[model samples]
Target: MSLLDLDHDQRKELAERVRQDYEELKSKDLQLNLTRGKPSSEQLDISQRLLELPGTEDFKDADGTDVRNYGNLKGIRDIREIWSELLGVRYDELIAGDASSLNMMFDLVMYAHTFGTQDSERPWNQEEKVRWICPVPGYDRHFTITEKLGYEMLSVPWLDEGPDMDAVREAVKDPQVKGMWLVPTFANPSGHTVSQDVARQLAEMETAAPDFRIVWDNAYAVHTLTEEFPEVIDIVTLAREAGNPNRFWHMTSTSKITFAGSGVAFLNTSTENIDWYASYAGARGIGPNKINQLAHARFFGDADGVRQVMRKHASLLAPKFNRVLEILEAELGEYDVARWTTPSGGYFISLDVIDGTAARVVELAKGAGIALTEAGSSFPLHKDPNDRNIRLAPTLPPVAELEEAVRGVATCVLLAAVEKLGA
Candidate 1:
């Protein structure tokens, strides 16, 4: 039957059927959660060797520096080399550091607001207000970091190529616009990759704020679900070619690659920016744990090792991703009630329901004994302007559970769409 032709009675009957099915499923009380982007236990098991790599006798690096010691402020060389390849930049451009690259990103914003970037006329903190361009359907944590620092967020629409370049150009022309937060590779929530052309255009922009740096967070650089990989713009190279040498700050972590809380992270940027950052960061801590760095070096060794590990992750995660997609396709593909992304790689699939229906869909899913990432969690300040986007995280749950959870979500979507259309 054509969905468009369904009368009020038919729609009401379908909604009632959905509710009945949901009640039956809820009676199972099957506690299932698909709300987080964490790797499954099986995926984590692949890196168990990392925990056993460091024994009393094995506590030294390639240069014979005691791993137990604490003097390598810029991180051990071998770890830098591993992340250098993982991030697709030169070893010199990367600065391997402690486990949280997010922390480094936070510090960069603080630095800009206080000390300012290489070409700033004055400190940003002294200004009346500072603004940051945030691509909607972006990483919440990235948005939170800037918001916590009191920077005004300007939401820019995220398109297939990248954040709207036209919007970005116009926004950055305002002097108060200090920077932009970008997840260029396999962006969080949406799982979208910024195209090389977009990257180049971003690099070439003539912002009114001289200190405006693109906070490029390449968290999922190696996380791919398809054989054909997305091309990363090598923003460092792009900035140089654009003659805006200090225009980008790149970050990545081995958190997903090795272990979540106990992995190495790094930052890459122009030498001048690095020098300015180090002047403060160097004084803040003795150094990152060099021992862990050496262990990761020994574990992955090179780009090939990193790729091998990623393939293992792909094998474990691909099934769960496929299950969600399959269920969504089977149940909802016939209807124009909702749409979702088929990401090549990344931790999430962003779903967009009929306008103004996302919140109701989420509520229905919860009532049916399934939990999802809250509606509007993808946008800055937890507001998707159209109220349509929902982030689906398929990595945390096992495939069987994912299938059931997504099916429940599909029912909720249809019911919500019908109700909205009726209203």
Candidate 2:
């Protein structure tokens, strides 16, 4: 039965029972964490062969370009081809670089901030006021980037289909809305995918900002928890067909695919935009780490090789996600105190506790030695106005520990909900 149906005395009885459980949890001295969505050791081990890849003598691309030397600002073609086929971009258009896609994003934004994009009338820093459309229940790190750069991050509903297009369309009518961040495939906390219809709409829509850009961060483009991989939208083509050739600054990385610490990152865009990025990027460095790029290319001979490995990842990850869902269903099913996403792919399970109680739930879980992604982490400025959403990372923890942490989270949710009522 829903907790709302309980009378005051019944509610009091329940609260005491839950509180007792919470106190007992604290006494157990548990130390379980579900905070960051990091790949497990086993997942990392799957690609262990990468450590010996592109060995000392094999440091040159098929084109006979020595990777050890510093000069392919566009990176080695072999690595670019791997992701290019997977993400559906042309080989020459995809530029490979260091491990972190986030860094690539930062550099892209910094470039525009300082010098403006292909169609910019003036640099973003010189604009009277700059705003960015950020979908709520998004990656915190994405929000961190914009906040650091002083962009007034506007909230758009991140729905099952994708960001609410009507809202996005309305928001972009203002030219000051320079750009937006999108995790198009299996988005960070929500595990949502942008439908082709939505993709087309976003591409075709008119924006007041001549140089408006979409930071299409397809971080989980291949990070699935199921057999079927979601479609990798041809966003670059979509925008170009829409006459917004410079619309998206597409990015992806092999950080999770190979070594998290050292994998290749990529950026794909129109000819004009790619050249613009190269000009700004060239002044900063002679070239990216081509040796690492070469190693990654050899590790995954082709796009199918990348797919074969992700299937292994899905095998290991699916179970943890399933266990988390099972526990959430069993523990919180009756109370109607919360609801969460059942994502087929992506690193997080976005949980929403009772309204005005998410922060309380996190606090309660922490007291019981359970760590969760901070409350409001999936929003602009790290503030969930209703205090209802919490992001759970099931990938990092072992199954046994994940269960403990999630169960504890359920207890906290229950206690927080009842306390809000009992008072």
Candidate 3:
């Protein structure tokens, strides 16, 4: 029965029972963690071939450029060519970088602060008050970058079709608002993809700042956890068609597709934006890790090769995600106190538990030796106004451990709810 349907006596009885279950759970002293969206060790093993790939004899790229020597600052031409096809951007528009798109993303943010974009009036640091729009229930690290850089963060609603563009349009009216973070496909925790119409509206919308940017982080372009593959709207094309050619910047990496630390990352944008980033990045380093890029290129020789590997990833991930949903349904479905997203792709499932109970849920889980992503982490400055959202990552744990961890979370949810009702 729903918690709201319970009588005072019923609530007290349930509370006592839930408290007993929780005490027994703590006695188990089980150590299970669902904090970060890390890939399982078994999943990592699938890409082990990368270790021995692009062997001693494979130092030269298709252009016969000796990759062993450092010269091609734009990354290996062959690798760029493959990414261009996989990412659906012009060959010259995208440049391969070292692993970690997160690293590349921070670099771009810093570049804007230091030198500004190709069309900025001045460096962002020169502005009296610089700010960026962040959609709620979004990536925390994105907020961390803007926050650490001293930019005021404005939170907007991220609906099923993407960030509420109406709210986004309204937010950009301020001249101080310089940019917004867009996770166009399989967004970090919510798993909502940006619709084509929303993409067009963002492209065509007028901004008070002439150099406003849309930092499109398409980290899950190929990481679908289901059989159906939905195509992402061509944001670059839409932006250029809307006469805002340089308004968007796209970043992606094979970090999830291959070895996280050794995979390749790429940045896609207009030639002007590329030139702007090149000037800043070139001065920072001679070039990216070409050997690692070469291995990735040689391993996934073409676009189809990339898709085939992603299918393998789907096989491993889909079950873990399904298991998470299954546990939530079995334990909390009838309560009417919780709701969760059944993501078709991506590494996380967003769960919204009873209001004012998420922190308690997390606290109880931690006390029971089951770690969850800190409550309110999905919001800016780590504050969830309602204290209702919880992000569950199920990939890192084995099936048995994941089951136990989720059950522990469900128990806490019930106990917290009962306590909230003064049971």
Candidate 4:
């Protein structure tokens, strides 16, 4: 029977039994971790050729520009060409550089703070208070950026369709609400993909802030862990059609596609924003690491090559995700005390345990020597108001370790539920 279905005596008895089991688990001293969505050693090994790419003899790009040199602010055209096809934007429009998309995102926010975008009348930092719409049960790193930069984050409900568009439409009526972050495909923590209709609405929605921007961090556009890859509408096209040519800045990276830290990052948007970014970036540095760009270009060779590489990634990743789902089903399926997403593509499984039990479950897991993504990590300010959501990252651990880690989580979930029901 479900925890809620049991009588007070039964719940109390169950809680005691669960507590004993949890104590026994703690004695094992297991050091398994599911804290981050880092790639496994096997995953990293797949891209080993990248380390020795563009071998000694060949260092020139398609245009014969010596990649070893220090200039090509817009990135090498050949590399841009390759990403453009995958991103569905024009080849010349992409600005390729930086190993981390997060770094590029920070620079954009800093630039907006210091100098403002083309449409902004004044710098963001100068404003009394700048706010951005945050889709909850979302990426923690995205929220951290806004928080660190002093941006007031307005939490919006992330629906199956995407962030609640009606709420987003209403939230933007306030003039100080500068913009919002968009993780369009296989979003972090929750694997909700933004449908084309939602993408169009976000691009065209009326806003009080004339320079409202969509920090489109399409980090997982190509990181599908399934055979069925879903594509999103072109935001740039939709924004321009809606008379807001510069409404969004699209950022993506090959961090998971190739080497996580040693991969190429990209930013694409309107020609106007591209020029604005280039002018500011030119002042920041001469150019990006073109050698890295060349290496990636050589490693993939073309867009199709990139797709083939991702398929290989899916092969390795899908099984781990399936294992987590299977364990949750076997252990907690009949409890009626928990629910989790069966994502088609993404690095995580977003789990929602009984209300007010998520934190306790995480605590129990930690005591048992299994490290999980801290409760509330998927929300803004590291706070899940409901205290019910837990993000399960299955990518970092080996299959054998993941099985144990997930079972431990299931045990914690059951224990916490019983304890809460007992009370």
lDDT of each: 0.85, 0.90, 0.89, 0.88
Residue-wise lDDT of candidate 3 within 1-423, one digit each (tens)? 898998888878888999999999999999999999988888888888889979999899888888888777789987899889887788988899999888999999899998888889899999999989999899999999998989999999889788988889898999999999978888989888888878889999999999999889999988899876768566787888899989988999999889877888988888888888889899999998899988998888898898888888899899888988899899888877789998889889999988899999999999999999999999989999999999999889999999999999999998888888788
* Shift of residue 324 alpha carbon in model 4, Å: 0.3
Q: Candidate 4 on 1-423: residue-level lDDT in tens?
A: 676787878777877877787888888899999999898999998899998987998889889899889888989987899999877887756889879999998888889888988889999989999999999888899899999988989989889979999899999999999989878888887898998889888888889998888898898888888776678457787888889888888999999888899888998888999899999999999999888899999989998899898899999999999999999999888778899998888788899999898999999999899998889998888889999999999998899999999988998999998777654
Q: Find the number of clashing residue pairs for candidate 2.
A: 0
Model 4: residue 159 alpha-carbon error in angstroms: 0.5
Candidate 4 wrong stretches, greater than 4 Å: none
Across residues 247-317, which tens digit of lDDT does each residue of candidate 2 receive?
A: 99889898888778888888888888889989988999999999888888888899999999999999999
Score every model by TM-score.
0.96, 0.99, 0.98, 0.98
lDDT of 4 at 292: 88
Predicted structure 2: lDDT: 0.90
TM-score-superior candidate, 2 or 4: 2
Tens digit of per-residue lDDT, candidate 1, span 1-423: 545668878777877886677777777776778788998889889999998776668887767888798787778888787767766787777888888889899888888787877689888888888999999889999989887888899999999989999999999989999889999988988888898889889999899988888889999988998665566567997898899989999988988888888888888888788888888888788888888888888888787898899899988888778888888989988877778988879899999998898999888888777888888888888888898999999998878788888888888888887777662
Query: Which pairs clash (backbone N, Cα, C closer than 3 Å) in model 2?
Result: none
Q: In angstroms, what RMSD does candidate 4 have relative to the true structure?
A: 1.2
In Å, residue 336's CA in model 1 sits off its true spot by 0.8
